[model samples]
Target chain A: MMQEIILGDYDLIPDTIPSEGELHLRVKPIDMVTYWRRCGAVANFIANFYRNPQDEIYHLNENLISTTFNELIENAAKYSTKRDSDIDISLKLYNTILKMEVENICSQKHMEAFQKSMEKIIDSDNDELDNFYLNKIEAKHAGDKDSGIGLLMLKKDYSLQLSAKITPIEGEVYRVSVHAYYNMSVE
Target chain B: MELKAGESILKYNSADQTVTIEGSMRLANLMEYDKVSVFLNDAATQASDKLTLDMTKLNFLNSSGITTLSMFILATKKRQNPKLNILGTALFAWQEKSLKNFNKLWNEVEISIQ
Candidate 1:
């Protein structure tokens, strides 16, 4: 049974129930302004959702939400190919861990390098990560079309996994999904 | 770049080594690396022995913005400036942490968060 939840431009999957809450954000060049606005909106929404009086499962902090959305929007802006392409965003709270998945359209080559960069960044803390970001920015050397560490940093700091694959739908339109996790250790 | 807020227009004087980032020092359209590199190059070219970042009405700044500020601090340190002053009023918590973070890299860049 698939659930349906619609918020903003996204049509949430399995739109039947809220067993595990979810939010879907559609990404398009036209919605660039709204996309950034929704990034903050989703961050605050996650904070409020977990801080509910009725729920005692997981504690979602503001920094985690902010970091998650910041990375998500960065990826969305970088990967969304079409002017009106929608980026699918969904968050699931499973037991003590919260999983966030952001999917959009991009090439597989971009996903590979993005994954490697993310692992390296996640392995370091604030100081090292800052240096790495600076080095990359200074290098100014990337593939002809690269998304850089936008996806990688998210998964690294937030324990994210980008399940990037070419989903061939309607001839040659491919979709990519990037997932990030927030667990008990995230403080 | 000129950004219009409520009643004032935020300006970045590329030639003067002074950028008045008001309202939100954070720009959504800019990526972290791109912003840092641009600021560093600009600071290197425009600034002299002293670099002044006039953040009077800045209410919000993200991690990238922090990185940009740190880069400015780093550039001044590389140049061995006598006084790398970051003057501002009413800075956000992130900005304070960013200043502290920069202190770790270049201790002499005096930051006053009023």
Candidate 2:
């Protein structure tokens, strides 16, 4: 069976951005887990690549972009079922709006869990999201590992529109593509 | 006591009852943040009157790090002894936004952003 789900603002993810304003990075999940620092390094590189010295908000946007990208990369690396497979990350700039997409292979179990979290975020109002985030933090258990706080924090902290597309691959594995749109003009 | 990993540094000064976290922290997962959680929890326990967390120099922190901090805050709230005071700088946009969310966790938490 093949399935696809779009959470929010799926139409905003364009087919392309100008060559000068687009960047793509590919990394294996194994390297991300073994060398944890690679996540920050990749994020910083992409942030720097998009920074414009002429813009007065360069420093602020640089930090914000890096933090956003870092979370996406970390989540992709953590949930991926095939450690040796490549996770593709693409960043595009359309005027003041920045679009980021990350695609990775995950087991059916992981994809289902990810979809549930994304759905909650897209469905909640501002107050509900805040309460949900706080409850998750307070309900932390010793054995319960996945907090799903990264995506929640992004939803709560930034003016980012989030969505994901899941495509069935084989028996229980699937390819999940997560998309995020951030409007720098608002900041 | 201090924990230095990658580009970040976490330090505790018993004399001043302050834990200064500098640089960026992007630890992989919850397990990787255990040491930092322990450090902050220890600092929380040792402070009798007030515990201050200075994050002015911390330019970046991933969600895992934020969760660790939130857990530390909740534990301190449960103890209800050492009042928690977090010192952040408005220079970092995240501090202006995310740090305030700590207040919702514990309203009594005093957050001062300079």
Output the number of the DockQ-best candidate.
2
Interface RMSD of each: 5.3, 1.4
Q: How does model 2 score on DockQ? A: 0.75
Best by lDDT: 2
Query: Model 2, residue B47: displacement in angstroms?
Result: 1.4
Error (Å) of candidate 2 at residue A176 is 0.9
Error of 2 at A86 (Å): 1.0
Which one wins on TM-score?
Answer: 2
Docking class of 1: incorrect
Q: DockQ (Cα-based) per candidate?
A: 0.18, 0.75
Tens digits of per-residue lDDT for model 1, A1-187: 1122122212232235354555555546447544454555554565555565454654455545555665576556555667577777767765666667767765555544544655465456666776775565444333222334444345333444334333544433456565565565444
State the lDDT of candidate 2 residue by residue for A15-119, as single tens digits. Answer: 843533778889999999899899989998998886667876523377778888899999889988989998999988776778888899999889889888899
Weakest ten-residue segment in model 2 chain B by summed lDDT: B89-98
* Cα lDDT listed for each candidate: 0.53, 0.85
Chain A, candidate 2, TM-score of 0.92
